[model samples]
Target: MNVSTATVSLALRDSPLVAEQTRERIKDHARAIGYIYNRRAASLRTSRSGIVGVVVHDIMNPFFAEILKAIESELDRSRQTFILSNHYDQLEKQRTFIDTLLQLGADGVIMSPAIGTPPEDIIVAEENGLPAVLIARTVEGAQVPVFRGDDAYGTALATNHLISLGHKRIAMVGGTDQTSTGRDRYHGYLGAMEKAGLPVDPAWRISGPRTKQGGFEAAGQFLALKDKPTAACCWNDLVAIGLMNGISRAGLVPGVDVSVTGYDDLEEAAIATPALTTVWNGQREVGRQAARALLDKLSGASVKPSQELIRPELHVRQSTARPVERS
Candidate 1:
């Protein structure tokens, strides 16, 4: 009660300048008196909104949800507020979100950049004082700290696992070539096929599906291929699960009649109709590291612009098996 006006102000705002005991005492007294601190006023005074932005492809997707959970946990420890957005691979939507963050003076952003996101977009955000960290996907010329799983390595693990099960005619289902992630995953599948001395038919690469519905819809096309693939290496678990469901709809037993492999061992993969064989893409680690890198940048630490790739592991399950002849 005898503290200077400045000390009272700092105490109400939870600033460390106030002693812990005094700060708690002041807070308790304020609560007793029904005093509410004005966060907006505090933000204006300190020039820090305490807000960080996280934009990803889709929040509903379990893959991104896992990453976001990790990010939220890390940011919670720092007592930083975060704003989340889904660009849905739309460049314009992503740009709009970045602009909004800049206008609101957000401290930083962690993004799994939208498809075709130019490097300049990332540069512009940084130049305007919003430091950037990339996750999941990469913009070729963006010089920012990036945290993601080794896509090529992860998909390669899935492909190789299917190959090990004696699947020679393997198809890569889901994902497009528009984003770096798509390209890396496809290349991983391709490389694994080549390395295994398996002939890759052009039709085996089914691009343009990154969702469960997309995968489900693509099932007919997949099944209709003249040279039927004995196994499918899906873009992610969602797609693999969807494809498996479609396989069942078509009266074929997945894992028995047709084997399927998925990337990103999301939580649902294990409980899928036939437990999915998948690659552990380290989504949580990527999210945690990306959030930490951005927080470091906000704390005035020098974060070098580099690609940090978390190594991936393969988890074998019921959805994959040796090739069975299909009439």
Candidate 2:
């Protein structure tokens, strides 16, 4: 009770300089007295808000949701508060979030950058003292640590699986080439097709669909193809599930009439009517590693600016099988 004011202050801040027992005693007494610690005042004094920012394309997307869960767990373990933003691939929205984080004096950021995000945006953020770690996407020349699955390799695995099922005519549905992820996935599909000596018709690469609705709408166009493909390799699990539903609505059995493969083995993929054959893209690993990298940067540890690609595994399920030729 007679501890110095300096000791009480340090104990209230949970500073390591204060003995743990003393800190606990002080916190208990403060709570008993209804004394609320002003975090704003503490941050002004220590120049650390204990806050981190995370911005991604879409929080509603299960892929990002999985990643966020890991990030939240890791940050919580370190006693950090995190702010999340969904840019929806809008560069302006991403920039606004970054700017807000900076204004709020956030300790660091972990972002799965928006499509069309220029390297300068990252550079400026770093220059302004907002250390950032990237996940699920890359910005060239950003000179920051990036954590993501090997998109090219992951999609290649899906394409090769379809090839193994003897699908000579395969369609790649969903996704656009506006971001590194999109380009990598498309190239992966293209490369795998070429490696298998399978012809990739120009019409087989259906772009601009990254959601369930998009995939559902694309089904009619896909079904109407003069030389309809026997299989579709979708950009993600959501698209694959949607496409499978569309196939069902059209009275075609998805696994039988048209084999489908998906990327990102989201939880829902395993429960779909014909359980989806998908690529495990390591979303949680991406989130956890990215959070650690940023925390390391915040702690004044040297984190190399490099890309860490988590290897993906293929999960075979009911959705893909030997193709059934249709009239």
Candidate 3:
């Protein structure tokens, strides 16, 4: 109480200008007296709400779960509060979340934009002084920094792994042609097939899926084909795992009866019953780097807008093997 108001202010803010012992004493006394710091007042003066908004397609998905955990750890270290939201690939939902963040004066946002998100949507956020960084999917003409794995290269790696294991008739399962990521993965699979000197029937390409349920449903059609594929290169781990379950439900042993490959080497992949073979799409790396970039931007650090593509690695396990000879 003897200290001047200026001293109290500096000590409360933990300003280094205050002596360590003095700052400790002041904080102790404040705690004893039950003095609560007004965060709203501090934010009003600094124009920094210390709130970061994160939006992804689905938080419940293991792929996003890993990414979000990494981002959360990084933000926690910086003492930033993060709000999470899921747009479920809905444009209206994504827009609503962004609007709410803007209203709260959020310092920044890291988003895996919804399908069909236009460049102007991102631009509009920046125009409103809400800086944004992208992850996973990208919007065409959006000049903001985006962090994601190399989708085309990642899928090619998965497809090639299957091919190398003697899977000549490989079917790509569970992904839509609507998003750039989907298109990239499909192209990668197609390119790998062509390069391997393998024939790909147009019927082998099954589009419009990115979830486990979708993959599970696709399994019926996959197994019913007159020329059933010996292996399926799934869009992601969720699809791969689901399809495996479906294969089992259809009275077929997955690893032995049919080979399967998935993108995104999720944590669950190693523990799956058949142990999935997959491409490590660097979900954690994407999250960490995106969070760092957004924090840097908020601190007025010069962060150049560009795309950072993380290289993918293939992890082989028990799921892939030589294609069974069907007489």
Query: What are the TM-scores, per candidate, against the unseen true structure?
Result: 0.94, 0.95, 0.95
Residues 1-327 of candidate 2 have per-residue lDDT tens digits of 889989999898789999999999999999999997788878888789999999988887888988999999999999999999999889999999999999888999999889889999999999998999999889998999999999999999999999998999999999989888999999999999999998889999899888888888888888998789999999998889889889999999999999999999999999999999999999989989999899899999999999999999999999999988655
Scanning candidate 1 in windows of ten residues, the lowest lDDT window is: 36-45
Model 3: lowest-lDDT 10 consecutive positions:
206-215
Question: Which pairs clash inside model 2?
Answer: none
Off by over 4 Å in 3: 2-6, 16-25
lDDT of 1 by residue, 73-183 (tens): 999999999999999889899999999999888999999998889999999999999999999888999999989999999899899998888889999999988878889
Superposed model 2: Cα runs more than 4 Å off: 1-4, 13-28
- Tens-digit lDDT string for candidate 3 (89-205): 999999999999998889999999999999999999999989999998878898899999999998999899888888899999988888888998999999999999999998988
RMSD (Cα, Å) of model 3: 1.7
Each model's Cα RMSD: 2.1, 1.8, 1.7
lDDT of 3: 0.92
* Residue-level error in angstroms, candidate 2, position 164: 1.1
Using lDDT as the measure, name the better of candidate 1 and candidate 2: 2
lDDT, candidate 2, equals 0.92
